[model samples]
Target: MNTLFMHCRPGFEGEVCSEISDHAARLNVAGYAKAKPQSACAEFICHEPEGPQRLMRELRFAELIFPRQWARGEFVPLPESDRIGVLLEHLSNLPTCSSVWLEVLDTNDGKELSTFCRKFEVPLRKALIKAGKLQEDGNGPRLLLTFKSGREVFVGLADADNSAMWPMGIPRLKFPREAPSRSTLKLEEAWHHFIPRDQWDARLNGDMTGVDLGAAPGGWTYQLVRRGMLVTAIDNGPMAESLMDTGLVQHLMADGFTFKPKQTVDWMVCDIVEKPARNAALLETWLGEGLCREAVVNLKLPMKQRYAEVRRLLDRIADGFKARGVKVSIGCKQLYHDREEVTCHLRRLDMKPRPSH
Candidate 1:
């Protein structure tokens, strides 16, 4: 076996390598990961022959903390001249695939490779169709070809249902001028990432009520209001006059850490600037005490050991919920709009069987 490659936020390659190494070991699949800081990618090679298939079966992409995109494949090196012929020759040997996506590392040089990919896709598609390898309507494996340069590439296959829809795991969203701050995009992105699109209208019902802790200027509250939710915006500072004018928001001049809703609400959102552990504790209190049905919170990270801190905070939250005999659905992500922080969504599952994993 060649290797399983994963792309992540540049400079966090070490964290991805560490996590994948642990997961591989946990599954009793021996492997070693090679990662370099700022490389934007990592590769894991297994000592066992069936490790790649085992990894695909055992690990879900959403559970990973650092890796944004991944594939199980071997590297393919193309010849300098007559590159199309070399690409076609390699394609002829692989299993039939229905779709294809060309990727590159998230780096300065890697960005420039997109132009070449755009030009190459046309002829590649034609060749694939002519060779009877591109099934138009069939549900088959997706071919992910990651270009390191013009001549160097990695050819991988991952199930379409299990992979990300975006090319580099980045979603394209337009900022609404009505929102007071760009931070509104963070919540929008978080919703898109955690909540499946088919269930959005149901999850964001019009009659929902929510409280926005640290909701100065109403950036996050704007999203809640858009869903027709009555929101209590908590903060000591002044909020955007435009948001208050809508009559859907009530601004409270109170500290977020000490404030509590008068009754249980549908949602609780927090964007306070504090240590990761403190923010985690606040979420724990809200969900554990049954103050809200669901909550979205952001935790700022330190420069060193960012992954470790996230794990510790999540563990604390999980422990608290377990002690209270509650089952909580917890999700976390480092959104494109975030800087040195990760957003988390926690929802209480009172009537459902708690997941052991």
Candidate 2:
């Protein structure tokens, strides 16, 4: 049976392929890929006689949808009506996903406002007519409903309650209507995809320490702090007062590239507004000097050739690490909230390397 993984962003197909190839090769495995023209997705065929689910599960940004050619309904619960466009783009990228529906639950009084949804023939998978009638605690059924025009949307129901939103092409995302702060969920979404959930758990358990380059306002730092890890936030600007209050953060008002950590950290994260190459070099310096064990950083891309740039950088980073007898596992994704940039996650080959500055 053929299983496929759906990667976001049409432009980054080549980069996705390169990253996949490197990942497989690093594990001493092989696979084949070609553009899946019909859906604008990449089809990686595992020539070895096993199913591709294992590989798909290992991928960070690529989502695994089963029964390659099957059609199913998808419900995307938006934070508000404004997110409709984001919902649309996300649905469009699914290899086997289509026929979108919008379920606008009335939040004034919590209720399933499926009037618009009914017009599109959205199946009443479950009618919590009363559920949609209550005043929304900002978590009502503001879902972006999708499926093959005439198919049911419950084919691959996830165990989570947030309602899954497909990873679509996003240039940038504004803040959602009901978040505690005015920060953009779209941007956070993009940033979240860089590091896999598994790796995130490790960091949160105090199994890691990281450096947050250009970490002002502490958005990324907030994520690290919640994970219960110490973060050396390197930035000249002030971080959010709440972040400093956490006591796990060490405010380092200095240049990220020039400042070396007192000891080897578990990870390095950068979000500086420098050229991609400069960011790449900074990562190299950290790795070359063994300042950190692993990394997850952002590369702000130029308007055009964003895909090409990602490919080039990944190759350089991999080559650099390999030459130094360091093995690395890396993945990049154009997340649901990303704009003109991509995020990378890297793990060192030598899990237990000697500490060096």
Candidate 3:
């Protein structure tokens, strides 16, 4: 296949296109991206036949901010009389896949295809297994059947390790009824996206401490409290009484930008409404000063050139840390629960003392 198909939030197709095009150029892959406004997806068509495979091999999906999920392949036209037969014939020429995901876009039209996709999955799975094209070999790629319409589908393959674990790159998280605000899902999803689940027990345990900026109503703080972490909720507004009742939170009336922890904390999370650059600088100060071992902060995007703005802010953070001789692992994502903002995770790796002149 010569195309890389990507699924993103509707209205963000332009960002996805911009991002993929930049990556392709950096990797020396000759390609151009195409996206329709609010289509909820984009495609990168490569000049070379092997361009898609090369990009897939070199690109790190976790580092990509806009695309929720992506696959590499070409669109296939299906006959109404025997769609499964046509797909099976095409599959026979490809390698065995570990699993199959029948997907649709995240738009209304895509929603309409959900029932058809669900009904088509079982029969497709059976047919693939019978044809020896689908097997759980642990190392095989995932088969992605993305339906654009009843007669058109993109037959793609995605490396399980390099793609989003969830279908369409969206995690289904239910909002807690007790959460003071629905914004709680943002932090919950951030953890799922940034922190590896295998390390959660050790790194995100009850013994750890956290700080939540803009903590009024305790949406973000609630996540820390529920995880059994003692938290200092910093804000000039009232926090949720339910959170205070947990005895896990200490509310402080102060400005998030000026507040500093009494001691180094395990985590610092912020969801404050502020300029993207200002928020990033705040995160830099906390990390550069060794105030927190890890942090999850939200950066509200501007009305235009959001991709460029995000890149500039992130680069500024990296440069700031480098100048301070601090090593950190950073990751950013436009999470499912986020709107006009992206969440960033920064983990302190280690620090090297500067040599005296």
lDDT for each residue of candidate 2 in 1-357, tens digit (9 for 90 to 100): 233333334454555455555565665546765553233234455666343444534543233111111112233344434343444344344332212223221132112333445644323322212223212243332332323222222122111122234312322355533332332343355445444456545444465677888888777776667567788999998888887887889998898878999898987777777898888877777876788877766778877655567778877987887788766676665554444566666666666843332
* Number of the candidate with higher lDDT, 2 or 3: 3
lDDT of 3 by residue, 1-357 (tens): 999999999988989988999899999999899999999999999999899999999989989999999999999999887999999888877899999999999999999999999998988889888898989765699999899999999999999889987999889899999999999999999999998899787778788899999999999999999889999999999998999999999999999999998888889999999999899999999999999989999999998888988989999999999999989999999998888999999999884322222
RMSD of each: 3.5, 11.0, 3.6
Query: Which residue pairs overlap in candidate 1's backbone?
Result: none
lDDT of 3: 0.92
lDDT of each: 0.84, 0.53, 0.92
Best by TM-score: 3
By TM-score, the better pick of 2 and 3 is 3
Q: For model 1, where is the 10-residue window of minimal lDDT?
A: 348-357
Better of 1 and 3 by lDDT: 3
Tell me the TM-score of each prediction against the true structure.
0.93, 0.56, 0.97
Best-first order by TM-score: 3, 1, 2
Give stretches of model 3 more than 4 Å off. Answer: 351-357
Model 2 spans with C-alpha error above 4 angstroms = 1-200, 353-357
